[model samples]
Target: MNQYVIRPVRGDEWAKVKELRIVALKDPAASVAFLESVAEAEGRSDAFWQARAEGASHGRAARQFVAEGPGGEWAGSVTVLVEESGTTDIFDQHIERAQGHLVGVFVRPEQRGTGLTEGLFQAALEWCWSLEEPALERVRLFVHGENARAAAFYRRFGFEATGNVVPVPADPSAKELEYAFPRP
Candidate 1:
């Protein structure tokens, strides 16, 4: 929207970062895709939020971007974490390749259908491609198998199903579908 600006999150906007995260956790679709609960996020301390924002905004291995409205209210956000080759992940798997992991994607309900998400992804993927040596080979995201809307959107954006399925650690009965876009 013309009234909004999409850019890298600022270090001092931790409070707003917390607020947007709480709101995102409350979205109906969150239960299937996000691991955090609204109640849990609401319980975090201010210091935790500050640390989180600061790390995400400046961390060399990750980044967080936000869409701020004309009034400086956070409308949505997305974060990307770099997963390098040979590193072992919490999932007990070794990353045999270098890639960017897209996470914490959210767009407020009122901002949906206004092209905010596409713009957000553009900014994120562009940044990922801009990285230096061991340059990103791909950008990947895991979507709940039942999240058809999200899967459709990712498909439209040129990401393809990698046919790799990862079970949710918290809920073994659920599976996450891996999708990836190869760097151009």
Candidate 2:
């Protein structure tokens, strides 16, 4: 049997989702690895989290997958948002093709190097490719340039840099590097 049960989070699991997100934000690398600050996340209303959980739980446009450990704890999570062709993404960049953008990736420090990330990415990509209405051309993720560990992991997992660099909104001196994996 698989060591972890990898699955999409149900709407009823909003509390757990919220708790995990808080833990993720407290990680030492959260400054470079995540766009939102811990305070921002904490300030969000419970209603907001509930709605987010419901939306991601039922939509093709977005999904949040979690890796549930043997003890029913969440070890990691990855959220994928589908960007449609001809629309601007959250960053205001024009997207030329429908694709999946991986975000909110977090794995517990203890879970790192245990293949939990691979399991999360596998589930995320599989869901992306399974969509038929707006077939995704590729899956992409941005890594903070300063995050060498994450960048190396993405490369080892088959993502190639697309030569695109965007300045981090929060830190003008830093940049986020784009990496992509084409649909197979």
Candidate 3:
């Protein structure tokens, strides 16, 4: 069995984070799996990655969970961002409550179905609900309409479709389906 550890990433690990993210963007499923492209991410400055890593480190409102293999390779990663009530989200939608929005989900092809994805999510969700000053009302994620594999995993994990669909800003012809796990 492959051993792995799930934990929060640190500010100095920006290089590895950038490397993994760029690999994710190059994946064949990138168009539907991520909102950003390799060209776009590659164009970003080192300072951007530095801030991204720093902001997503432990104790930050946005946290990135990494699944590290025994060899120190990152098998997968997921990020959860806390959105305060009445604030505008990435899509400019008004958030109705303090909530956790799941994003940047990715796993190495070899790591898929090995429970690494679940481990990454568990860490992210634990951190989300642990917040007290602004208690979270739910955890949510958006899957591309045609991404059945991801949709199935989310459903299996207890997420239910909200019947809410939004146009993918990057591809106006395509849409994204909303899924959520309300605090239980």
User: By lDDT, who's the top model here?
Assistant: 2
- Candidate lDDT (C-alpha), each: 0.88, 0.93, 0.91
- State the lDDT of candidate 1 residue by residue for 31-105, as single tens digits: 886978988899999999998888888756888988888887888899988999999754566898889989999
Error of 1 at 73 (Å): 1.4
Once fitted onto the true fold, the runs of candidate 1 whose alpha carbons sit more than 4 angstroms away are none
Model 1 backbone overlap count: 0
Q: Cα RMSD (Å) between model 3 and the true structure?
A: 1.0
lDDT tens per residue, model 2, 1-184: 1779999999988898899999999999999899998899899999989988887897788999999978998999999999999999867899999999999999999989999999999999999999997799999999999999999999999999999999898887899999999999
How far in Å is the alpha carbon of 160 misplaced in model 1? 0.9
Candidate number that wins on TM-score, 1 or 3: 3
Model 2, C-alpha of 60: deviation from truth (Å): 1.1
lDDT comparison, 2 vs 3, better candidate:
2
Model 1 misses residue 64 by how many Å?
Answer: 0.7
lDDT of 2: 0.93
Candidate 3 lDDT over 1-184, as tens digits, reads 2499999999999998899999999988889989999999999999999989999996648999999988889988999999999898888899889999999999999889899998988888888888997789999999999999999999999899999899999888899999999886
